[model samples]
Target: MSVRGRRASFISAGVRFIVILGLSVASCWPFRQSQDIEFTFLLPPGRVECFYQPVAKNGSMEVEYQVIAGAGMDVDFTIVSPHGYLLTSDFRKSDGIHTVEPTEEGDYRICFDNSFSRVSEKMVFFEVILDGQGAEGGGDDEWADMVEPESMLEYKLEDIRESVESVHRRLERSRQMQTLLRAFEARDRNLLEDNLWRVSFWSCVSLLVMLGVALTQVYTLRSLFHDKRRVHT
Candidate 1:
């Protein structure tokens, strides 16, 4: 074969190999669709706060919560179904995980009640995860609008793109996990510091009280031992 022809053959072979690799990667990529929300908020005393989330029938909903900072490290959590049924109820709980599979398609309500608290407000960290058909519907249309493979090479390229997108999603998840960790650590540190301060304050107060008692006793003894009759004479 001519040198130019040989070079062309090698380039074609390389392109084919690259395309095949891309297709394989895409075929192996994993896809998932869901909705998640996280937040930290303060619930004031004598207040009732509620949030709503829409979910499709047969969908799964999960909630996890912790009292990050509060008067008692506990709060009231309640989840109501779309059909006006109470799914989960927790009173004066520091942390909990709740899950439900809804049978109706409608807006579900989650509430944090602080009405029972007369003076203490609560700071809470909570997350909700919903896995439902409705959440995946838009994703399906997006996938359909993506470029279709016209040839085997294009097919491989599409696969490569999917793999890359999967990687991107993983990295995003990792970042989110890191953020959550930091928040948890900060909350814990604050609690620790507060407890330490309380301990120190009490220790100082107890020491002063003891010293006052000792001084008072010493003065009382000196008064008792004094010769008042001799002084009068």
Candidate 2:
């Protein structure tokens, strides 16, 4: 083969490798073991909210929750199995994490109860993670079709797969960290707002009290001066 033609062929092969790698990564995204559902909601006083997640037999589920903003920053949390069996329960907690390994395939119920807090509504953040249930498959056949068995690229498939999985795990960790950080930020913001209001209110009250004391002193001094003048006259 001519030098130019060989170079062109090399470039084409590289391009194909990159394209196939990208497609394989994209195809694997939907098959991640840990699928997460996250939500933030306002739970009014004396109200309860429940959510359901379906899990396959032998699958695992996790629930994490935080009370980001509210009067007491606490709520009652509960998890129930599909067979009406209570799996977990926490009373008046500000944050919690629970995990369940189900023996039966069905929907599990997760609930947040605010009935104990009759006057203050709560802002709740929660995440549900379903694991051990992803479909098992890969794009190995696609890679095989694009690359010859004798080619050097075929030898690197295992390495490529490992790298993709590592990257995916890192992304999942990053996502979870971001979620927790957001919840912390929201709680901090609420605390700052509350402190600001309390400070402003007390400052105003102090100012009013100081003014009242000054006025009272002025009035007493003037009355005494008038009495002294009358006595001298």
In Å, residue 88's CA in model 1 sits off its true spot by 1.7
lDDT against the true structure, per candidate, is 0.78, 0.83
Q: Would you list the clashing residue pairs of candidate 1?
A: none
TM-score of each candidate?
0.72, 0.78
Q: Which ten residues in a row are the worst by lDDT in model 2? A: 146-155
Steric collisions counted per model: 0, 0
**lDDT score of residue 52 within candidate 2:** 86
How many Å off is the CA of 209 in candidate 1?
Answer: 0.6
Q: Candidate 1 regions off by >4 Å?
A: 1-33, 132-169, 231-233
What TM-score would you give candidate 2 relative to the actual structure? 0.78
